[model samples]
Target: MDKLEGKLHKLEFYISLLLQMVDDTKYPFFKLVIENQLSEEEVTEVIELCKQTEIDFYVQKEQGWVIYEDLLAQFVGQLNSKLPVNQVIKSLYDQEMYSELMGEFLSIIAKHN
Candidate 1:
């Protein structure tokens, strides 16, 4: 479970980095949600769920960010698909913009949850 938790923590760290580029007002809320989500058992449960579902959860393994499943990933892909070519390029190349986008996505998830 140590390896799994390590991976989970890595994922969280990337998320925190992404959130950093978003509205400062959202940070505390985001931090709360992330902290709540990061318990050891929770990480293990998440990994088990991913395994049972056979989802390619990791989007960028080197960066330790996971998109969970293709359906969810496709949704994000769709969001990116609508962007102007230049904006898309910027989103790809600009960490802050990418973080802002991910933060917006996380905020939406937090709202519905």
Candidate 2:
């Protein structure tokens, strides 16, 4: 795969994983996919936005691209929960799942390349 193709695939895989991690019904991030209305252009735009912001977890919502931190905060706020997005991310890192996930992602990229 070429560089752009690899990046697109990575973004798609990341978004798919995000969908699995969150409650799609409650998150606007998954709306496009769930409603079968997602477009390639939008996906590309989302990827570009993430690259520009240096944040890999941006999601394409109806209003536009939203960072994962904001999405998680909104979700937690709505639920009146004490668990913040940073804490969740820190927990993942503390458990080493983040590293495992990154390793898997790199392996997948290598296989594609």
Candidate 3:
């Protein structure tokens, strides 16, 4: 495949992984959140992170898709350093903006598929 095709393939793989993580409840963090095992402070922090992520996404989106993806990856990396992967995913899944983010990703996949 050519460069653009290769990039799209990589992005598609990443998106699919993200979708799976969001849907799967097997992770300990998912179970903990569901069982109300997290402290109120922990829940508040996750929610704050999710809101910040959403805002950052929209800001980067205006710059263009490539920049958006780059910044998003960096932002998620930062989040991963502070939170478990499953917690980050769960927090993002709970956001009102999650569907909109997924819709954008799905449309991109549809175009390439």
Candidate 4:
């Protein structure tokens, strides 16, 4: 496959993996996949490609909660597939901004059916 084709194939595969992860009961294994398989550049591309339609779904329900919006942006900002999401969660917690709600949002995105 060509470069773009290769990228698209990987993207589709990862997206499917993410969907499967939502229903997966194993947190540790899910974290491993997120850390190892999901690349920042690739996820970034996915975000950019989906941003228009994605609409930060969680934010809309709250009539656009500013904090959630900021958190969402930050989380997406650091989408290095090599990095585990816990790192971002830790940073947010250290900054006194992390919340279950934020985690829920990320979970929703990752596992949104």
Per-residue alpha-carbon lDDT of model 3 for 1-113, expressed as tens digits? 69999999998688657656665444544544544445667766655765676677777677665434454454456553435554445444444335555344434445555
Q: Candidate 2 has what TM-score?
A: 0.27
Window of ten residues with lowest summed lDDT in model 2: 79-88
What TM-score goes with each of the models?
0.23, 0.27, 0.43, 0.27
lDDT at 19, model 3: 52
> Residue 92: error of model 4 in Å?
14
RMSD of 1: 15.2
Q: lDDT of all predictions, in order shown? A: 0.44, 0.43, 0.54, 0.51
lDDT of 3: 0.54
Off by over 4 Å in 3: 1-36, 67-69, 78-97, 102-113
> Residue 34's C-alpha lDDT in candidate 3?
45
Off by over 4 Å in 2: 28-35, 39-113
Arrange candidates, best TM-score first.
3, 2, 4, 1
C-alpha RMSD by candidate, in order: 15.2, 17.8, 16.6, 12.2
A best-first ranking of the candidates according to their lDDT comes to: 3, 4, 1, 2
Clash number for candidate 1: 0
Error of 1 at 103 (Å): 25
lDDT of 4 at 8: 99
